[model samples]
Target: MPRGRGNRRQQDPIGGREQLPQWVRKEAQQPQRVVRNLRRRPPADADEEAPLEKRRRVDERQLVAMHPDVDFQKLLGGCDRLYKSKDLREPITIDILIRLNAALRHVCSSRYETIMFQTALNLAFAAFLRVSEFALSSNVIHEHVLHRRDVYIDHVKNQLFVTIKFSKTDQKGRSTTLVVDKNESNEICPLHSLKAFLQIRPGNDGPVLNKGL
Candidate 1:
């Protein structure tokens, strides 16, 4: 085991989702008819409730929720361009990832955030995971949230399997699995990075990517 003092990674771990309510379901679904009705009515200038961009994001979220496989993420990029509006996010171009890896090498912290997040970034890219798919949802329990038990790495086969307990796309809680296999590209190879991350054994229980010591 890697030698380090006790760290209070996440002072608490939720035991189950029954303890929490999924606000997204109620917030995101609006009977399509309601969506259409809302579109027909122009907002009053004095109402000033939510910004147009906020509405745009909700619309985009609906699109992604409905057609999870159509590369709506890319389509949303076009929306930003045509609307002459910009999303704060940018695509992970080759140059940016390279620069990110270089920077990760120099991050100094008590919780091993540098190594932890760097490995996670590599894994997320290889696994094509949405952050929400693995990250903790407020008030969610460990059974529904990710734990160290969820990751399985086959060093001999150079593969990894991550059990995704829940996803917006997988509403049935069927525990969708994500695979990360060795790729020809060494610079961005997730398998190798994950191997390195495992060597540290972040802990057997706790959020895989912890925020602090």
Candidate 2:
């Protein structure tokens, strides 16, 4: 079975007509596949797998060290503010989206296509509100899989989708989760909105969307 990422529906405020995109519909009708293929946890005394996790931890530590003044509290605070605001739209402009698409297009490989980049971007944005996260390090966001068997053996089959957790802060500095669902937790909710606004059609429009080969 493909990893189920769930579904999303858009409703017009004026006409109240609910709409679901074609890609979303297709994804619903078929099993969804993702690029990530790694075990969520290490096996018992697996010396070879230990090195990979160790390297990842070391890299994460180094990344944190490189930015000693990350101010995670501040970052979290900003995201909280955005989440609470009445504006349901995201702040990213079309220019930024276009630039990202262009860059991905330039580096297309024989194996990977634009949709992979698009979904990766979507997942990254879902995790972090800013595109800068992806721009800063595409490697971190890109989920690479060597083969189908690797995906299962690695225990990472179809785990590429992201989930958002909605929460609120109280005066006591404690946080309370309001909702935890895929549809509500979409970080690219704004970008998705913009895509809808532009009426982007699904076809061979360069980097916009590479639906099928």
Candidate 3:
């Protein structure tokens, strides 16, 4: 004979209570015990100074003790002078850039190479670009390196938009577009030089500056 649904025994709501020891079960049946609140230990004394502050105080005392007659401001100024750079790098001027362009024209073996070098120099000077921004460190092309596709020419606006995908300042790969306007001089005009270079540049995708092979 099959058992009916109503004939089955009902389970205890607290099923695991039977498995517990009698003492534990008895304790559980009683009201919950009062629990004392726990608290973190009090912070260090408010009057106590930080390690750096203490060190600074100690340093000041030593300085005063050793050099009682020396002026504190003058001593600090003298210390600062010790770390200052002595080498002064001369800034690049327009005359230097023009001379460089002229030198490249004579030095480059082919017109293609000359245009490429000239355009790069002009673009870098006008945009204030770092060498790593546009040029590849190795022979292999990186995603961050400027590509031919990254350059856009606006004939109507007479401006060229160059996208810098990565730079020292922009480590997060947040790209920035630099707008270079047409220069008055044909020799140093980035837009004019870029246009001439693009005309001869290969249609294949790669770094903007490449061997015209």
Candidate 4:
């Protein structure tokens, strides 16, 4: 499903009409498909999937909406639980940051893209960020993902803060700030990497994570 991630409003305040992305509209307009090969009857239905317990049931519909992945699986769940619970995944830990940064830089098309990946990875880990906080999302609007203007760095404190202007959790549009301080080792340092990245900053046309690729 396409989600809004930038600051642009997708709906008129008074009209209440949805101004969804064209691609999302097109996708919704497309006919739904079913598998003729399936002989077994579906086990779950829509009503059963609602939030009856503390958490929504993980059924076929829920699984399909999950937008499957392996490393991410067991790590994340349905979007309805997005901000309700905290993420306690261990794989996106700092212990493997250096290795991940190295691998990203190894295959980047340019010095710009490499710096972006390194900076993004370090800041994300250090600040405990969600991808939707700074990356370009499906609709690229309404979700309020951070752009370059949202980042503030303190050279004296050796820290960088990301200002999230709005979010699903903060429907009132109240701003929240997340900080990433300097690491002892420059190899996996969010502060150091962020400074270096700003020195050779990439395109500022969109989301901070956008490489213009």
Among these predictions, the greatest TM-score belongs to 3
Candidate 3 lDDT tens digits, 1-213: 464433445445677333544455588999863435446322335325555455676777798888899889888899889888787877678999999999996899999999999999999999998889888778524888889989999999999999998888998888999999999998999999999998899875988987775
Candidate 2 to truth, TM: 0.21
lDDT of 3: 0.83
- Give per-model TM-scores: 0.52, 0.21, 0.58, 0.54
lDDT of 2 at 152: 12
lDDT of 2: 0.43
Tens digit of per-residue lDDT, candidate 2, span 19-134 = 66667778799964443647555453645678767666665467677789797668879999988858677565545655675677678773245445554455444444334222
Candidate maximizing lDDT: 3
Pairs of colliding residues, candidate 2: 39-154, 90-190
Ranking by lDDT: 3, 4, 1, 2
Between prediction 1 and prediction 2, which has the larger TM-score?
A: 1
List residue ranges in candidate 4 displaced over 4 A. 1-90, 140-143, 202-206
| Number of backbone-clashing residue pairs for each candidate, in the order shown | 1, 2, 0, 4
| lDDT per residue as tens, model 4, 11-52 | 856899767666767999998656455775333452354455
lDDT of 3 at 180: 92
Better candidate number, 1 or 3, judged by TM-score: 3
lDDT of 1: 0.68
